[model samples]
Target: MNKLFRCCGALALGLALAAGGALGAPTPAGFVRAQGTQFTLDGKPYRYVGANYWYGGLLATQGPAGKARLATELDFLKQHGVANLRVMVGAEGLSNGYQYRVLQPLQPTQGQFDERIMAGLDYLLAELGKRQMKAVLHFTNTWEWSGGLGQYLEWNGYTGQPLPKNPGYSWDKYRAYIAQFYTCTPCQDAVATYIRYVLARTNSLTHKKYVNDPAIMAWEIINEPRPMLPAATPAFEAWMKQTAALVKSIDPNHLLTTGSEGDIATDNDMAVYERLHADPHIDYLTIHIWPKNWGWFRDTATAKGFPAVLARTTAYVNKHAAEAQKLGKPLVVEEFGLPRDGQTFTPAATTALRDQYCGALFGMAKGNTPASRVIAGYNFWAFGGAARPVPGQVFWKPGDAYMGDPGGEEQGLNSVFDADQSTWAVIDQYSKTIR
Candidate 1:
């Protein structure tokens, strides 16, 4: 057994002390404390310099290889002052039905317990602890494997196939299934158990002590949760309220954020924050955006400027940030990135877009715009991995293929890493001022 698992009895004592005397105290040794919406390391302000982690597949499967790769990646991140990692909890790659066959020994079915996945997480947490790196633990995915995609499809009465233009195939069934997924007894129990496991294993009382360790920053409820149909807003809001409460019940000290995807002020996205921000249990508000999808900027090769996109995106961010500030919380950009492949833009255009987009966004958040101090931090969509070739298209695949093809066209965001070193010096320079 891992050293941490052997000391479960000691966890209660640790929890008592953590909740009692150390409720508002600084974390032990290298750990930091959440001061309002910001983090204080030894009483000094610490803004997160983060990257989205897309390596659950390798980590959940090939233990040794995953460890080595993660260590190297974390080392690079740490060296570059990247302090946060957003890891998925019930991602498709970690679920039993999807790419994570290796976890079958632990969690044989959706309802079964998965020791392998837990062990893998333990290993990752231990490594992060060693480096004093903070983690944003994303609990669930909006993808197909965790039954979100499948459930959404089944509820809508659509076959497991392409995206439907009109999602009204079965509005009532869709809302029921969405509610069922969140409030269902078995599902809720499983999620709560998973949260407790993470808390117990990573808490300061455990030998691993990830929660108490400086490696864990916050717990993200879901990744890009949106209503499949317009009518599902009520159910989705209720689900967020309940889930946020469930997580806070176990961990009151750590921060909490909804991994909302898309613009925040918009009707579909506003409901999530409206619920979460009003709930006293939630600690922060988060949103994700891609300029191409919102039509904020034209993706043209000749006139590739992110100024328009930055203004459009930050307008919503500014509005939400102000509202969150009034609620005494900070606004976090959970996930954002520009595509380097799969688009019609040339390599030069892609590179220009990446630099200009990142520069403009970072510039705005760094006080160049009106919403400077209201914005907290951002985690670029991805890092590492090679580009995957699209089957028949000239450009590469667009998003990160964490499980399927790590070397495929998914590495478009790798440009962010490169740009951070060279063209995007302003981001690094501005990040210093924020902390």
Candidate 2:
């Protein structure tokens, strides 16, 4: 038997003996399992062809209307062959006063869980379960609500245009805050408490009914975890190790992933990957990739060109996959996208760029040695009915000219959305069959 299969067989045997069940019990349909460098769903190799739902969880917190909206969005996604939905769970939602700035001292008698946020999550998961959809639920926000300094400043209303100056905080003081935030002790234990809560709820649901529901693909430790200040590596690593251990202790049947967006280039990046891959509790590795200066769409042609971009991205994926394979796991490209900055790309160039980038990556995956299947999956940056009209932001609402036109001035030429039936047809052709 192949070594990876043997490892998995051993794991299955251990779980069976521990549960006092028969050997060869069938894994659930739509379940993802390691197969060489790729993942197999329902015993068949599959690749992700999906879109991100950034505000799904946020909107789902609004009660009945929010639940209805979520159901509508998932139905649309299912119709479009979207096999996954990447959802965000902002840390702000968990704690009342834990904004982006300096961490407030925790009161001795604070509640451990946030009932409103938990109720929203419960509703979201119930909806996903009802639809039989899979979600890559990011436990933290990478944008304004990220952990550490970014979130701190954002909470204080520091826009990216005018980055905030440090409030003269000392590293020693900050380290203590980090410890509390990660541990959540005396303030209700943030990371460990949240993971335990999720596991308990899901396990209870499994025991009661819907044992086969695959509502969540994995628990993402943090969204785009990066060291804002010097000397954060040790603390971050310790927190990750402890959190992973705590999560695994409760939910051994599901998987765990680190939501590291691959933009921060540092020794810490490789170190984080190494630590996560070495930990047996982590089932997969995930990274996000957007071309250099992609936000500005600078060097539109070169940035969007197939050869220029794919070289670095493919190399990054390969390196991570190699690391994950050592630990009997798969590397998943959890997020990748080319945002349309208002200026640079004329309608024609924009459409061309999109097609070329998507096609090139798909082609490369097919020809590569380990095969893209070994890389688990790829989720596009986003999908929504209407885009926000911010100038530099990725999603912009359709202008008057393109109203009611599905093609929207680009016919699979260079845009992110599927321009024609042909674009999605091509995607279906190259992507691993996921149903």
Compare the candidates by lDDT and give the number of the best one. 1
TM-score of 2: 0.68
Per-residue lDDT for 346-412 in model 2, tens only? 3323334444556665554553345343566767655543222233433223231111111212211
User: What TM-score against the true fold does each predicted structure earn?
Assistant: 0.74, 0.68
What Cα-based lDDT does every candidate model obtain?
0.56, 0.52
**lDDT tens digits, residue span 1-435, model 1:** 234532642463355445645565544555444444444555455666577774532363455656666677678767666667777654322332333122222333344456666666666777777888877888765544344434333433444332222245353444344544543455555555556666666432246555555566788777777655555566657777788888778776577877876443235465455666668777777877766655665554324545566666667667776666666666677676665533532223345455566666566565334355446677766654222333434322224233221232332334344323443454465555554
lDDT of 1 at 79: 67
**Per-prediction tally of clashes:** 7, 14
